[model samples]
Target: MADHVLDRPPEGAAADWTIAQDWSAYSAADHETWDILFARQQQQLPGRAAKAFLRGLEVLRLSKPGIPDFAELNDRLHAATGWQVVAVPGLVPDEVFFDHLAHRRFVAGNFIRRRDQLDYLQEPDVFHDVFGHVPMLADPVFADYMQAYGEGGLRSLGFGALDKLARLYWYTVEFGLVREEGGIRLFGSGIVSSHGESRFALDDPSPHRVAFDLERVMRTRYRIDDYQQVYFVIDSFEDLLRQTIETDFAPLYGRLAALPDLGPADLLPGDVLITRGTQTYASERAGG
Candidate 1:
């Protein structure tokens, strides 16, 4: 099956614009795909993923086989963090997506990926959107951060700073790491969802993991097609919220405009370095 894209609602469509989720449209193979990804990630995430994410699995009862019903999940989610999942045809417009988040509704794509595309899927499907993301939303601190990000996203759109703001989401929401008593653990949805990236991110000694700094992160660029060359680690979700909430990014963007971007693997004198990656994997890939 091809990837799904969000379409504009038809005239006189419901005010909220949610499509009736075609639950039965899902084939056994699709359910199997969800099952495969779920089981694999569950087995791989024990020590690597943050404790909150794991607890969310049990709280949300995500261990059950097959795709989860948004209605059922919403009951638990709404009660826990006042966040509910809403099904969209696929990726919504930036404004729409932000509006949903700002209101504490996470817009998720209802479809699952085909089995052949297991290792890497280009677009986020139900498994990626729900399994990878929703669990983290159950955590209060993380939940607040997402809502704030949504409001910030809307502000950024108006200021033509969406790209800069997006880097914040990518670094923190998607691929961030956090310092735990056990050492660095995965919190970012992008890393927690993948079997290979999860292992590569933590166990492999290839990427630079530095403390989270808003300005530095906004100035940095990330690779979309491969593993990150650098990962920013946070002390706690509270630390993440406090830093971003207290910051007024308009001035920060001005400073960033005057500076050069850091290469994915480049190290800086100011960075509080966790590990200076050897860059072996990235070098080998470039040669190949």
Candidate 2:
């Protein structure tokens, strides 16, 4: 998840880079902030978020109140999918991240965003990490895919293909869309967590929507600073899991090493195009 790796854990963090969530430390204002963000997403996500994600929100009872205490949240998440959320100071080293995921542990930052920064945050906060991602982990299929991805990540490190592998996580986990009920829906954390992106991802005509292709996703470059110019859509979580677990990535990594990286919006003749965007948004942003 992090863009770069750190040499070691920071102060107060365990060797695994985990810190106590200390739920009691949050102030009343903090709870209010969490409520604000939670309420907004709940209002915006209806008919927009993936069905699995919405189901997760209901099953976890994330609506109960303020910031979720890891102790309580884990009780529900673990029972549902054997996944637990662990607290990290911020982004951990890549290995530390993958290790946590491989073991079905998700690391989330302990802090929530300031009220004024609600619309955007460069680093993920609890709201973004938990409200955005943890719900999806509650799904059995997506949970399996996450763990498989983590195990794959370890092997990727040995091949020095982490960059390529990271693209898979970025495109699928962070900014992915899924085909459902005859349309594309938001399944990616990056879109589901943002008020603006939740709308733009499905309603806007400025971005390309392509069918998910494993090798294609691995070779594509993604932008971290703005709305995604392209999104990869999967048929279903079952298919996504089957594709991840059945594929032999060793050779794929070798092939990817020799290929040139593609820009986020690049279109190929072989691609299964859903939306051939005008790139109007990106062009306007760049022009401005």
Clashes of each: 0, 0
Predicted structure with the largest TM-score when compared to the true one = 2
Superposed by TM-score, candidate 1 places the C-alpha of residue 120 at a distance from the truth, in angstroms, of 0.1
lDDT of 2 by residue, 122-144 (tens): 99999999999999999999999
Badly placed stretches (over 4 Å) of model 1 are 1-17
lDDT computed for candidate 2: 0.93
TM-score of each: 0.94, 0.98
List the candidate 2 regions with Cα displacement exceeding 4 Å.
none
